[model samples]
Target: MDWNELAMELQKEVSGQVLTREPMARHTTWRVGGPADLLVIPDTIKDLSATFSFAADHALPVTVLGRGSNVLVRDGGIRGIVVKMFRGLTSMTIIGEDVVAEAGCYLPFLARAAAVHGLSGLEFAAGIPGTVGGAVVMNAGAHGDSMGDVLVQVEVMDSSGNLTRVPAGLLQLGYRTSRLMDTGETVVKVYLRLRRDEPVEIRKRMQANLARRRALQPLNMPNAGSVFKNPANASAGQLIDRCGAKGLTVGGAAVSEKHANFIVNKGRATATDIITLMEMVRRIVWDTFQVHLEPEIHIMGEG
Candidate 1:
C-alpha cells in the first residue's frame, strides 16, 4: 500500500500524534538519519493497539523505538511506520514491593521513582539513558546489576497482536540481549522486584553510579551509548583502544576518546561517517586480536 494512503487511513482511525516524512535525526541519539515515511506517537494503549492492527492488516513493516538512546538510524531512514513510545505512555506505580513501569518510562526515571519509594534493586539503572522497554529488551545493566536480576515479569505484545504477560525466567536475558528482541516481540511493561532500603542509601548509591558514568562515558557528545558489545572475555572498548582507534575521525564522526566503544557525532556527521568509523574499528580490532566485534547499538534504516 502507498504510504500516503495508509497514513490518511491511519489518521482517520487513530487518535494520536502522527507525522509524515518525519526526520529520523530527531528521533535517535546519534542524530544522523534521514526521514521516515511515517511516524506515530500513540498516547494511549488503545491508540497503540489500533495502530498495530491497522499496520498488520495492511502488511506494513513496523518498528517501535523507545527513547532512541541505544539505536542508530541510517541516512536513508526507515520504510513503512515508526512507532515511538515516550512521555505519553509513561506510567509508573509501586505494587507491594515491586515497581511496575510502562514501556515509555525512562530507566532513570524508573530508578528515581523506585528510590523515592525506598526500593533498592533499581539503583544500578539510575545511570542508564534508555527507556524501560529498551532496558528490558536489552537487559541493560551496569555496576554489577542487570535487569535480569530485578525483573519479575514482562507484559509484551506478541506478533499476532495480542498482549501477554510473561514471567521473567522465560525472558532468557543474556549479556546485552533478551528473548524479546530475539523473538521480535514488543515489550509494553515490566514488573521489577525490589527490596526495601533506606531512602538515603538508595539515593547515595544512585549518585555514586551516576558520578562513575559521568567520569567514564562521553555523555556531553551526541552518540549511541555503547557501539559494540563486549567480547566474550574482554571489553570491546579496551580492544579498540589497544588498536589505537580512539580519537580517530571519519568526516565528523569519531571514536570517542573518553570511551573507545562509542562513536560520537561531532556536529554534521553523516550516517556514512559513523558506518565508516565503525567498520574501521572493527577491522583494526579484528586484525590485532582476531575478535570480531558485534554491535550493541541497534542500527536501522539505510545510508
Candidate 2:
C-alpha cells in the first residue's frame, strides 16, 4: 500500500530500472523539469506490459515518456509512476519491404536504417530527435512528410496492459496530430511501409534534410524543436519574426533568433520563464497578424 512496497514489488516483476524521486529535468529536451515521484524504464514490451498491469491493479497514476523531445515539465514535478520506454524496447527488423521497429528506437536511427535498406520515405526523420512511439503519437514530420505517410500498423498497449495491433486508418492522424495524442495507450511497436529506392539517392536526401535542420535550428541550445505549429499556410517563425519578437527573453528562456518558433534555455531556465515567453510571443503574433498560435511541445507537471 505504501510507495516503497509498490516500488519493491515493481522491481521484482519488471525487468528494468526503477528510481524514486527522479529528476524529470534530466529526462526532457528543454532540460528543465521537477522530479518524478517514481520513474520506471522497461526494456521490452513484456516488461512494459507488466509495469502497466501493476499500475492498473494498484490504482497508481501512470505517465508514458518516449525520448522527451517535444515536452516541457514544470517545477513542481510529476506525481505517480512515470514509465519511459528505451533501450530494451529498441529493436528494428526489416520485414520484406516494411520495417518493424520498437517504440524506443530513435527516429533518426530508423531513418538511417531505412536508407541502409534502400527504403525510401523516412528521409524526413533523419535529424528528428524523437522516438518511433512519440512520432506516431504526434504525427511528427518535416519537409512535407510525416509518420502517418508511411505508417501501416502499430502495436499499442492499453491502460489495462493489453497489447493490440491497430491499422493506420484507426489512428486518425493529421498534420502533427493524432488520436493517440490524448489516448492513454502506449505505443509498443510501429510498422512502416516504404518504397524501394537507390540507397545513394536515399542517403543524399537524408543528408540534405540534416543539413537544412542544422542550418535552421539552434541545435547547439537546449530547446524543444518547434514551440508552435504552423498556422494555416503561414509559418509560425515568419509571423514571430515579423512581430519583432525574436530574441525576446524572460528569465533564462529566450526565443531563438536562429528560428523564432523555437525558445531556447540560455542555461538554468525555469519552466515559468519559458511559459511566460511563449505567452508573450502568442499575444504579439495574435495582435499583429490576427493568427492564433498553438504550442507543438507538450507542457506537463505544475509550477
Candidate 3:
C-alpha cells in the first residue's frame, strides 16, 4: 500500500508525527511485537479526525491504541494505520463532582486527580495501568470497582471521522468487555461522575489500594497485567494455580509465581512465547476445573 508515501501524505494532512514501519513493541507494555505499516501520533482531536478521514479516503484500516497496557500485539505486527493516543490528547478538567478527561489521560493520573479534588469514586483506579479510553473499553477495574461505575459518557470517533457522544449505559459494559470492542470506534474523551469526599480520606483509600496491588501483582516485570478474566463464580488465578500452572514456562514467557493470571516477560520474551504460555495455562485450568477462562487483555495485530 505504499506505506511510506501514505505516511508522508498523512503527515501533511494532520498535525502529528507519522512514521512507516514503526515497531509495535515500542507502543505496548509487554514490549514484544513486530512493526506496524504506519503509525500516527496525533497532537489534538482535530489532528486525530484528520488522520481518520485520511485513512478512510485511502481505504486503510485503522487501529487505535491508548496506553497499550492491556494489549498483546502479535509478532507479525499490524497492518494499515496504527493511531497511538498517549503523549497527545491528554487534557483533563474537573467541574463540581464530575471530571472530564481526554481519552489519552492516564487512568492512574486521573484517579490521583480525582483524589486531589476530593472525589471518592476513582480510588479503585489508582493502580490500573491504562488510559481512560482503554479503561472504559475494557471496563478496567481494581479493588472491586471499574470504569463503568463512574463513567457518564464518552466522545467516540468512527472510521469516517464522525464523532458521537454515547452514554455509558449504551456501551453494555460487563466483565472486562463493552460494545466498543467490536465497533472499531475510537474513544476521544470521557466524562466521569464522582462524588465529593474529603481529600485526605480519598488519598488514604487510594494509597491502600495501590499498596494492595503492589503486593499482589507482578509489577516488577514486563507484563500485560492479568492475562485471563475470572470465570463466573471462580477466580482464574486460583484455578490456574490449583492446576499447577504457576511458574510454567514457554520460551522466555512464564506464568508469574506470585500471580497465576499473569505471564511475565522474563527478558527477551516474544509475543508467541506469551501467547503459547497463555494457551497452556488455559488448557490446564479448563482441564482441572471445567471452567473456560476468557482473555481479559486484547490480542491484536497479525498472526
Candidate 4:
C-alpha cells in the first residue's frame, strides 16, 4: 500500500500518534542510525493489537522497539513501519507481592517504584537502562543479577498476532539471551515477583550499585553497555584490556579505557566505524587468546 493510503487506514483504525520517515538516531542510545520509513507509537494495548493487524493486512514489515537501548541500527534506513511502545501503553500496578508493569515502562522507573514500595528483588536492576519489554527479551541485568530471576510471567504477541502469557519457567532465559530474543516477538507486559525488604536497606543497595556504575562505566560518552559477551570461564573485558585494546580507536569509535568491552562514540562515529572497531576487538582477542568473542548487543538494519 502507498504511504498516504496506509496512513489513512491506520489513523481510522487506531487513535495513536504516527510520524513519517522518523530519524531513528533520536530513538536509540547509540545516537547513530538512519531513519524508519514509518514510526507508530500506539496509545494503548488495543491500539498496539490494531497496529499489528494493520501491518499483517498490508503485508508490511514491522519492528517493535522498546526504549531503543541495545539496538545498533545501520546507516541505511529501515523500510516499512517501526512500532514503539511508550507513553500510554505503560501502566504499573501491585499484584499480590509482585508488580505488573506494561512494556513501555522504563527499567529504572520500575526499580525506583519497587524500592519505594519496599520491593527488594529489583534493586539489581536500578542501573539497567531500557524498557520492561527490552529487559525481559534480553534478560537484562547488572551487578550479577538478571530480570529472568524476578520475572513471574510475561505476555507476548507472535508474528501472526497471537498473544500468549507464558510463565517464567518456560521463558528459557540464559546469560544475556532468551526465547523472545531469538523469535523477535513483541513483548506486551510483564508480571514480576519480588520479595518485600526494608525500604532503607533496598535504597542503600541501589545507591551502592549506582555509585559503582558511575565509577567504572564510561557513562559520560554514548555507547552500548557491553560490546561482547564473556566467553565461558573468562571475562571479555579483562581479555580485551590485557590485549592492549583499551586505547584502540577507529574513526570516532574508541574502546573505552575505563572498561575494555565498551566501545564509546568519541565524536560523530558512523555505524561502519563501530562495526570496524568491534571486528578489531574480535580479531585481537581471538588471535591473542584463542577465544572468540560473541557480541551481546543487538545490531540491526541494512549496512
The most accurate candidate by TM-score is: 3
Model 3 residue 303 CA deviation (Å) reads 1.9
lDDT assessment of candidate 4: 0.87
Clash count in backbone of candidate 3: 0
Alpha carbon lDDT of each predicted model = 0.88, 0.90, 0.90, 0.87
RMSD of each: 1.4, 1.2, 1.0, 1.5
Each model's TM-score? Answer: 0.96, 0.97, 0.98, 0.96
Cα deviation in Å at residue 217, candidate 1?
A: 1.1
Model 4, span 3-27: residue lDDT tens: 7667777888777887777788878
lDDT (Cα, tens digit) per residue for candidate 1, span 1-303: 466777888988777887888999998888888988889988777778877888788887789999898888888998888988876678888987978888989899889988998889988999888889999998999988899999999988865668899999998898888888877777888888999999999999999999998999998989888899998889999999999889999999999999999899999998889989999899999899999999998888867
Query: Which pairs of residues collide in model 1?
Result: none
Q: Give the runs in model 1 whose Cα sits over 4 Å from its true position.
A: 1-5
Clashing residue pairs in all predictions, respectively, total 0, 1, 0, 0
Off by over 4 Å in 3: none
